[model samples]
Target: MDKNISFTLKIWRQNGPKEQGHFDTFQMKDIPGDTSFLEMLDILNEQLIEEGKEPVVFDHDCREGICGMCSLYINGHPHGPATGATTCQLYMRRFNDGDVITVEPWRSAGFPVIKDLMVDRSAYDKIMQAGGYISIRTGAPQDANAILIPKPIADEAMDAASCIGCGACVAACKNGSAMLFVSAKVSQLNLLPQGKPEALRRAKAMISKMDELGFGNCTNTRACEAECPKNVSISNIARLNRDFIKAKLKD
Candidate 1:
């Protein structure tokens, strides 16, 4: 049976993007070890509502770790201390009784905090809109085996396609660079036949948009890969650099 534990939560509180933020302490007692991190927050919110106090604000959706909406910086790690997992997947069992857990929003210039733990991650969407898709139609959907993609190449593309746009890379990076995210998106599509025609243009446009949005340049620190929930590789960044340089050379 899972035992209940107690802890102190020091969560960041902010009214708006421009407002100053600070930590608000809350005591959580007798929490089930199996309770998910988000479930614990829900219990706290319920307690606050019953007491007629304002509740903490945070972003979460599809708690199954797919949407990447839970942008929590828990104890200095993006999405808690769990490896290859999102915040929603984190459980209280990871911490011991009476531990002081600190929760904060992603502290990047590109991902400004909206209120408390929620930040305006629309910058990612904007970067995607810049050139993350293949506009050219590859005709009607055909059989999966028709394209004749080799196993190794197809596997690499699938791995790159696993990026969920969580922005954990930005939060973990000392330079707040989005190269990992952007590179994953680029590699997934560029590796396939349908996206090959415009691979260079796609890479160039997305990178330009990332820079225009004030995201920092990649400095080879590889912190982004270390903290990425999907473990998106920095090698993709190298591929992005090669593609970008090729595009520039053509110009």
Candidate 2:
């Protein structure tokens, strides 16, 4: 049977990157349990608009667990208490009636507050710009199996490729590190044949960009892997370290 539940929401609000921010509490009544977390926010925003108040600002796109745009810290957990799920995939049923849910943005220097829950995650884009690319010959369409890859290797690469660049790992880490994100990108390409040629270059360049963006160091607490919506493995980080070391040695 389906039912509705009420919740007390304590959501963070900010005007801009340089402005001070604070939490504003609101009462949500009789919300459908099957409603997604983002949909619940939509309801609150609609109420605020009707009241002639500013609607809470947050990031979201493709609310179907892809795109990774729904980045919210709910009740001290990135993307809420659910494991392997994005905020948009989180249902209101996970909470009880009268629960106080705290919502905030990703709190990393690399991701400064842009408005309320939206942060300047362009630092991630910069890191990817530094190396997340391949140099392929201008080509006609090739056969599907033109390059025969081992099944296990292809599967591993696909797993790493599943990363949506959500930055949940950074939000969940105490150090606000971005190792898991960088490593996943690095690993996905490194495991494939075409990426091998530039593997060393990609590793060093991306890591350097990540460090330059004011993101913190990885403490190996595994918080990143635990919070990652895509479940990107920490083993990729090991591969990244090795690749970085090898790149340095080559230099």
Q: Which candidate comes out best when scored by TM-score?
A: 2
lDDT comparing candidate 2 with the true structure: 0.95
Per lDDT, the best of the predicted structures is 2
Candidate 2: residue pairs that collide:
none
Model 2 C-alpha lDDT per residue in residues 99-202, reported as the tens digit of each score:
99999999999999999999988898999999998988897979889899999999999999999999999999999999999999999999999899999999
Cα lDDT tens digits, model 1, 122-142, are 999999999999986667988
* Over 4 Å off, model 2: none
**Backbone N/Cα/C clashes per model:** 0, 0
lDDT of 1 at 101: 99
RMSD in order of candidates: 1.1, 0.8
Q: Quote the lDDT for 206 in model 2.
A: 100
| Model 2, residue 208: C-alpha shift (Å) | 0.7
